[model samples]
Target: MTRVVLALDSFKGSITASAAAEAVRDGWLSQRAGDDVVLRPMADGGEGTLDAFAAAIAGARRRPVTVTGPDDAATDAAWLLLPDGTGVVELSSTSGIEVLGGQLRPWDAGTVGFGEAIAAALAGGAQRLVLGIGSSASTDGGVGALTALGARFADADGAPVAPGLRGVASAASVDLAGLRALPPGGALVLSDVSNPLCGPRGAAAVFGPQKGLDAAGVVAADAALARLAALVADAAGPAHPGPATPGAGAAGGTGFALLAWGAALVPGSAEVAELIGLDAAVAGADLVITGEGSYDDQSAAGKVPAFVAQAAAAAGVATALVAGRIAADADVSAFTAARSLTDLAGSAEASLADPARWLRAAGTALSRTV
Candidate 1:
């Protein structure tokens, strides 16, 4: 009997990692009932990081908290508390772009909610922090989050700065004295990005357009972030080079803020894979199947499929691929068998409309090859 390990990331808007794994498992089992199959849902510290942890870790509790949203409204969000006292906080849950719906508030959206959630997790006696900073909604240089964490930002007149980028632009002073201390185990930032806090390759220049910033707005946002960096250096000390650190620009500069708070940045996929014991699973399996929503050029760079495939290769196990859409430029040579749900459904729309169904079909087809 062939032992197959299924490690699939979320199919973006189509399906959750857990659901996708189950659907594929069902289909694979239908074809090879005697085969051993294992499900290990994967994430790259994006929108599905929390769900991935909850699915992989037994006895992980969801601690709910209400905090300020990107749009300055109260929003209910939850963080995962593992049995080992590691609190997994996903920025997307609290200050994600989705929370803004279609109302893009590039200048006004901030990450206050994300920080509040982190504070809540710390207050809950978390010994460690796994901060997932992805799908952010703001370009406030993380001032909002810092403010929520007890770091104060005041205007020249000593009044509290307004929320969002406006606050960042107006802030003349920062005080980290009141900021909460890191947990006993310290904080690790989960991010796949490598952009710096300011400049052309930075957060505002490259990511602001997607968050609804116009050309002028992007320029203005970059300036605001630069100012924040200066303030952070001043308050945290000249040796604090958080702004220039790779991944500091992730989650709309939340990474930088976390760095200021003494968090270390690490590759999201690798750290998560290690935590979920992916290497052990791959080593024991005959073949491993992994995938994502779109297997494109970017997939090779710390994405779930690439990370899984690399692990599988190191163990001398064959690999297969199942994805929503396989881009023409995507190199899929790592997988012995590759299937695209879009192709299986005959169109992207149909595949997206019913991802699970197509995913099951893809699973069955791959099983046939096996």
Candidate 2:
């Protein structure tokens, strides 16, 4: 190989995109030392988003900020400050479900931490904001985050609403008197999922179950979001913008909040890819490799691997995929080759137990084949 590009997405509970790329590079070079390897870690605006930016950009600093977690507890979180003054805030870092450690907060989890980190980035002089909204733990319609930014969610009695969905349910009026103005360069929302904010395909009805809500819980949360929507419409002016828009349901309605705040919504994978110069890299590469934790029907829906494969194909470059598992329905016919950790490691348990080891095994096998 004259040149090989390794652009892998994160392995969920396992290795990061960058780590997997490095492991693959090490394995590939062990067999073909003459080849040049370029690493491009990728994410679909989710948890590993900051890592992707840090890996691709020179002088992108990881700014650490202490913030409140979903459970109202203090936690350590960090956001990326790109060289061009873009503040990249990832929801999963501070307000994601994993922060609960397998426990369910349901209506109790909130995005105050996410807002605090963004506030820190803004304070540090971010020219623009790029919010990656995914892996959220709450269904507060982003009231908590907006509150941290200066809007107040008050109940019918004029008392400040409590955190999480409790606040959402009690919300009767919104106060934007003290809400901070957007930065001069504005904000952008990054999201892959396109569920709307209310109804059968809405945030609460579709995502509530995954966050531990039962049937009744889902209904109540949906009602609260509806109430919040009304409040947003009355207070937000301009006819409530994106309440029904695709991706408005992201991060448990945090995307809706960003939209209400005048942020532009864009496909997370494509936006991140452009910012990281993925198209240029693919144009120059002899071969391209991409992967994820699982390659299923969802992979075709703007996931990192699919997006990377599309980019590579557009550039007339050969592409391959590696994953922990690949579904029969996964449409990978466009790729030159595909490998899985399960087949390479001989078992699912083995692959899960040690993904890097299995990934490296697959990488070595891949090097010989290519």
Candidate 3:
């Protein structure tokens, strides 16, 4: 009997990692009842990051808080507190584009909700913070989040600025005087993107289009991010984070703003994997399965699948993937075998409408082969 590990990333917009792992385990059991199976839910600093932490940490509890959302509406958000005094907060839960549904507002969306949740965690005696800044809807240069922590963003008239490009463009000064101090263990900002805060490869230019910004809006957002960076550095003095730092452009400059608060940017997959004990699980497994919604070239770039494959490889174990859609040009050579639910279901729409059905089929196929 094979000792298999189900370490799958959440199929965004469909099944989560926890659900996918269950289906995979069930299907594998159907094929080989005696096979040993280990479930390890995975994420790459995106939507399901908090779930991953909750699965890994003992005594992790959800702390609920109400705050203003990206759409400028009151909403409820939850931050996680680990047994070791670590706070887990995902920006997507509070200020993500999904919160607004199909109505995308790049210029006006902000991350104040995320900050409020973090502040709540701090108030509860969190000694450290693990912030997941992916899938955020805002490009406010993180002024909104910083503002919630008591950093002030003012215009030329000394009046407080609005969120997003409006605030960054008309900003003349900033004040970090009343901002909350970092926890004893500081902060770890998770992001896989290496883009700088402002430039051609920056947040607005590269990611703004997806956030519903036009060319002019992208240009404006970039300049605004630059202005925010300069103003922050001027006020913060020597601890200023350089603009060229990797991941400064993440979540619309939220990564850069976190740096201003003296946080370190780390690779999301590696950090999460360490927390979830991926290496230990893979060590004794005969095979490991990992996947995502789309297993493409981007997945190879430090996403959960590639990271899991690397860890399994180091342990002399084989890794396989079961993805929602597999691009023809995707380099999935790292996997011992790759299966696509879309390919099995005959169409993307059909596969997405019911991902678990095909995901189970893929697991059975892998169980027989692996």
Candidate 4:
């Protein structure tokens, strides 16, 4: 009776983490019904952060709210409230690029919806906040979100600026006096990025293009972020190290705004893992399997699979890997058996078209090897 633990993250647009775990579990059980299999869905503060919490935490309630989306359209989103009074808000579900429906509004997309969700969570009696700032749709220095939280951004004449980067570029002053206070337990910012708010390695330069910003737009947005950071410094009375702080550029400057609101930055996967008690789960397992949408050099950089493998290694448990696609350059030395859904399906399109089926096949193959 072998104890095998499955900790897999969402396959991005393919499948949810919980569903992937169940599919793999089913296949593993089909091959070895006597083995003890545990399903532990994982996420790194991205599209499936809420799902991960929903599956792992008991008494987690989904609180729904409607707000302005990236394209300035009405969006319905939900936040998670845990039994321990922590409000988990994922930016991807509210203001992520996916909400644009394949349309690109680089100049006008904003994050007002993300902030509204956080506000809703706080108003729902949450004592703490765990904000997952990933998959953002805009690069407005997070001013749009700040605006929804009662922070006013105005021009030289005291009139509200335009929405999105257009408005951020012309903003002359900021008022945080009306901004909501932090919860009793404060807020924690989760992100996989470490870029600052501006300059070469910053948000606008590194991530702006992915959100549809052109080369010229990236330059303009970087300047606007600098301008906003300056305004924030003036309003907060200096000593505000948010602009240049690592991860400050996350979710298009949402991290910087949250930092101004007194939130501490932490690695997303590690924090989520701790929240889900992954260490204990891996420690008792005879074998562990973990994976993500893509396994590459970046996967080792605080991603879910790497985090799980590290925990399993600490417990002296053998670990296997499964991924949608394993890049040629990816170092899979830590995994005893590495399998790729793309390879199993013989084509990337086939694997993505039916991820669950390939995931089950991967699971069965791993069970056979074990």
Candidate 5:
């Protein structure tokens, strides 16, 4: 009987993280009866972040508030209040691209609502803040968020501009006087990306297309971000280490904003794992399995599975991965082995429509070797 820990991210468009974990458990149990298993669903500060954190802290309160969406629409979003008084804010709940429906434009999205949510959590007496910066639809470099928090981004005319990366280019001044001072302990922003806010390989070039930006849009967005960066440097003195670090381009440069506002940039998966006590869970496990929807060259660039694999490796535990699909001949050195659910299920549509069946099958196959 092997003690196994199943930690998987959401399959995206197919299954939730919890369902994916359960599928693995059921599949593994079918092969090895009474095997010790622990299920820990995971996220990279993106779509499933709130759910994963809520599940980790069972029965937590999800407080809803109105925030600006990707299309500048008033939309509902939530923040979690745990029993321990730590407030968890997932930006996607407010400014996610998925909430846009058919209207997807990075130039128009904003992070103002995210700042409002933070303020709401503070008013509710939250002592610590854990902000997850992923799955955003804005490229304002967090200018909109700051505006929501009382920091103003004004044009040369001294009038406020609409939120999004487009506003960044015209930004000539920033006012931070109105921001509510953080409590004595301050806040911690948990970002999943390391890309800088500006430059060729920065936010716009890497993430603009994902938000429906064309080549021209990318170029414009990049220029806008460069202008915003210059403004930040003028205001804050210099670009911080974590903001300019790799993976900081996440959530359309929200990571840069966090750094500017004095948030620490720990590894997103590592921070989540620490919060959920994954090290303790791994110590008692014989094998650990983790994965996401896709595995490719980018997985090495701070994706969830790679983080889990690193943690498992640190614990001297063997790890395996099961994704919906694996990039052809991708580097799997991060895990002991890797497999694709699509390979066993025969087709992507079949696998997505009936993920439970395929996940179980894939788990069973991996269990034989583990």
Candidate 6:
């Protein structure tokens, strides 16, 4: 009997991470009658992050807090904490694009409440802070987050600006006197994006459209980010690598803000992998399988499958990817092999109609080759 580790991301609108993992297991079991399999579902700090983390940590409490949503509307979001004083905050929980009810305008969104969430975690005496920077609907260059944490952003006239992306562009100066109030330790920001804070390939241009911003809006948002960057540089002395780094453009510029706040930037998949002991599991397994909802050129940009493939390759383990749909340009050759559930089901509609059945069937088919 062969031992296998099944780690996969959620199939987006079709299946949850756990379900996908189960489907993979079912496939393996069907083909290999006496196989030992371990299922570890993963999320990239986006829509399913809360569910994924909840699954990962046993006995973690889900606590709700009120934060500003994408539309400047008051909404309640939740975070997780363990008895050991480890706290987790997902940026999307407060300012995610999904929470906006389909009206995703980055200019109007704010990270203010995200900062408040951090404050709450600090007040609760959390020893470790894991900040997930994914699925944000804001493009305020983190001004809102900074403001919530006690930093003051003032215009040239010295009056405080409203907290949002609009205000970030007008920021002429910043006051960081509030840093004294932060918890007495470091923070880790888990981000899955690799875009910088400014320029053509920056956050605004790369992600603004997804948040309902037009080309003009993207340009404005970019300018706002540039201005905010200047303000941050004035206060923090210098910009950090993670904010200006390639992967920093994720989550509507939230990555830039986290970097400015001294949060350590770790690959989101890699962080989750470490928590679930994925490397160890892969090493002990005869085969490894991982995937996401969509496998495209962007998947190479720090997505779950890419990270898993990298790990498996380093460990000399054979790996396969199973996605709901595989992009035409995706480098499938990068993995030991890759396939889509859609291929076996004939069409997307058919596969989605009964995802579990298709997933299991697809997994079984792949198991024979392994």
Leading candidate by lDDT = 1
Q: What is the alpha-carbon lDDT for the whole of candidate 2?
A: 0.86
Candidate-wise lDDT, in order: 0.89, 0.86, 0.87, 0.88, 0.80, 0.79
Worst 10 residues of 2 by lDDT: 233-242
Instruction: Give the alpha carbon lDDT tens digit for every residue of 1-370 in model 4.
Output: 9999998888877899888988889889889999999888888887899887887788999988998899888999999999999999999989998899779788789888998999999899999999998778888888888888899999988999888888898999999889899999999988867779999978889889878899999999999999999999888776577599988988888889888877898888887788788888888999999998888876775678888898899999999999999999999999999999999999999999999999999999999996
Superposition error at 36 for model 1 (Å): 2.0
29-54: candidate 6 lDDT, tens digit per residue: 98787989989888776656767778
- Cα lDDT of model 2 by residue, 1-370, tens digit: 4799998988876788888888888888889899989888888887688887787789999899889999888989898898889999998888888788778888789998888888888899999999888778899899888888888889989999998987898899987667777888999888867788999988898789878899999999998898888788778887557589888888889989877777888889998798778898889999999999888865775678988999999999999999999988888897889999988888888998999888887778888897
Ten-residue stretch with the least lDDT total in model 5: 238-247
lDDT of 5 by residue, 20-43 (tens): 999988998998888998988888
Candidate 2 is scored at a TM of 0.89
Q: Estimate each model's TM-score.
A: 0.89, 0.89, 0.92, 0.90, 0.91, 0.89
Better of 2 and 5 by lDDT: 2
Clashing pairs in 1: none
Q: For residues 1-370, could you state the per-residue lDDT of candidate 1 as single tens digits?
A: 9899999988876788889998899889999999999988888888799998887789999999999999889999999999999999999879998788769898789999999999999999999999998779888888888888899999999999988888888999999999999999999989867789899988999789989989998899899889889888889986575688988888888889888888899989898798789998888999899998988875775678988998999999998999999999999989899999989999999999999998899889999986
In the range 71-176, model 3's lDDT, one tens digit per residue, is: 9999888899998899988888888877887688887899998888889889989999999988788888888899999899899999999887677788899999
TM-score of 3: 0.92
Query: Better model by lDDT, 3 or 5?
Result: 3
Per-residue lDDT of 72 in model 6? 72
Model 6 lowest lDDT segment of ten: 177-186
lDDT score of residue 215 within candidate 6: 92
Candidate that beats the other on TM-score, 4 or 5, i.e. the better one: 5
Total clashes in model 3, counting residue pairs 3 or more apart in sequence or in different chains? 0
Ranking by lDDT: 1, 4, 3, 2, 5, 6
Off by over 4 Å in 2: 327-336, 346-349, 368-370
